[model samples]
Target: MIITVAHQKGGTGKSTIATNLAVELKTSLLDLDKQHSSIIFNYKRAHAGLEPLDCYSIAESQCRFDGQRPVPEAKLDEFLDLFKGDPKTDLVIDVGGFDSPLNRKALFFGDYLLTPCAPSGTEIYGLQMFEEILQEAEDIAGIHLLTHVLINNADKRSQKRIAEMQAYVKGKPEHFELCQSVIGQRISFKTAYETGQSVVELHEGARTAKLARAYLHSADEMTALCAEIRHALGKGV
Candidate 1:
């Protein structure tokens, strides 16, 4: 399935999820939106340079916004055409922030849109807006929007805000889901991306590999969630 991790605000572990999830499935990644696809650097958290794990069949790269003027609507069609032949090969797209043209393309082309949200008020507002946008877009595009809301990257300060977020999404079953994984706060993820790799690749002898292990398991869970979402709705949901 073509899973697209997108968010209105940046730094919600979109790249990390896309990269590590590909690693979990041993599938290729089509990073069609990120300018850096930070998932490439897997050793940012390591003090000592660490050798990356064996390369998976991931097509890690950034989407080129080759336009002089503002972005047009046809960009979505162009990207969709590239993968029209195959959108169900364990594909993962780390779409850029919500406002980018590539993000629009991804939304139009995505089979399952995975939105990573924090519990902060600002993030909550963004998620609410995102839900509205998705609903309108789905109506316009004539496609079912299977967008899953996964809580991601909550620090001590943010933990207090989840109940509020939970309240906002209390009755929205068709639009949201509380993922089984918490993906608790961790700095290793930011570090790994800064160095062009995943945490698992950074240190097998990780004195503290708990975060890495959680991420791997979360990715596995995401796969199952994607399947469930597809089954519940139709393709291109």
Candidate 2:
């Protein structure tokens, strides 16, 4: 399965969520957002050292994507050629935004597109606009919505934020679903990125350590949800 984490908006934690999920799964991972590299997470996993585990093991490729816009049909054909050539691998592309040509290319590749949003209403409205664009593209292209919107950077302790997230999700079920886990604002995540380490690998005694554990829990739940979604969509093997 190719799950592309994308949104038309920035700072929504798309790379963070997608990168961590790939590490958690230990399968072949692909970072599609070229301009903003996410090799930091992959570097962390490598520094953490390899285990005797079979999962999203990424291939030898540049973390930066250099595909042309609209993913020219030939590009899609070439990708499909390579994609189908390796049926055992699962792919995850971290697109900068939902409106990018990379995302349009992903749709043609029969991949699932997921977008993350914050608690802000403007961001929420941006997501709606993003969905509108996607739907418009979908009218001409054949694609599937594995799962649409995922709430990121949420503060569960805030009754107001929780209510806002819930309300936004409820209002956009046709194009979104609320993730069960909430990722609180944690500085550890940003700090770990500099050293290319999972927040779990950083100083486990500080506030960052606490955030790392929380992130792990969220990733676990998300991984399971992804599996269930595949089954529900009849895309599982």
Candidate 3:
């Protein structure tokens, strides 16, 4: 499976979701984003003498683009060609925020496209625009795109707002479906990422009891969410 986490909007936790999912799925990560956040996180994991993410392989394609210049089509093709040779191994791609031919190609190649959005009016508007992009891609490619929208970095206290977001998504069934699992804003996520660890791998001893419990909870939630995504894609758990 080729899973692509993409959005034209930034600060939607794309790296967070892509990294954790890659670790959990034991898949190869193809970092197509210029920021190289995922690659850097893996480097930290290695430098800390941490056990490498089990069965994880990584590749990066760094592209520099000016506002006027289009991303090279050949470059996008080269990165995607990496997956064509290995159909059995799953691949996760982390794309940068910015609409480009490169991103569109990735979207077309994806088995599953995930767009993460925070709970806010502006982010919601971004989601709408992203859905339109997805539609355009599907129309051009003549394929039924399997795209999902996930709520990331939500506050635990904002159940009402979360519900509103869910309702809004439900109203647009043709565009994308809301993910059942929501990722909350928590310090553990940041700490774990800094150490090149997934929430499930975070050591609890260094944290207060309450925070430790929260980390574990997030781990469980992420595990379930990963399973849910796999199942939705008709893959075995």
In terms of lDDT, which candidate is strongest? 3
- Spell out the clash pairs found in candidate 2: 7-98, 8-98, 26-55, 26-56, 27-55, 27-56, 27-57, 28-56, 28-57
Worst 10-residue lDDT window for candidate 2 reads 52-61
C-alpha RMSD by candidate, in order: 6.8, 5.8, 5.0
Backbone N/Cα/C clashes per model? 9, 9, 0
How well is each residue in 51-84 modelled by candidate 2, as lDDT tens digits? 3122221232223322212233345556544554
Model 2 misses residue 227 by how many Å?
Answer: 6.7
Please report, in order, the local distance difference test score of every candidate based on alpha carbons: 0.58, 0.58, 0.76
Candidate 3 lDDT, tens digit per residue, 1-237?
Answer: 788899989779898899899888877776666676777777777777775542222223433321111234456565566664355767788888888776787788887789888888888799888888888888998987757888889997998888888888888888688898898888888998998888877744446777777688778878988998788777767
TM-scores, all candidates, are 0.66, 0.70, 0.85
Tens-digit lDDT track of model 1 for 97-210: 657544655777776678887777888778877778777777877877757777777664665587676666666666676664555566666655665555555444345667
Query: Against the true structure, whose TM-score is highest?
Result: 3
Which of 2 and 3 is ahead in TM-score? 3
Question: Which sections of candidate 3 miss by over 4 Å?
Answer: 53-87, 203-211
User: What is the alpha-carbon lDDT for the whole of candidate 1?
Assistant: 0.58
TM-score-sorted candidate list, best first: 3, 2, 1
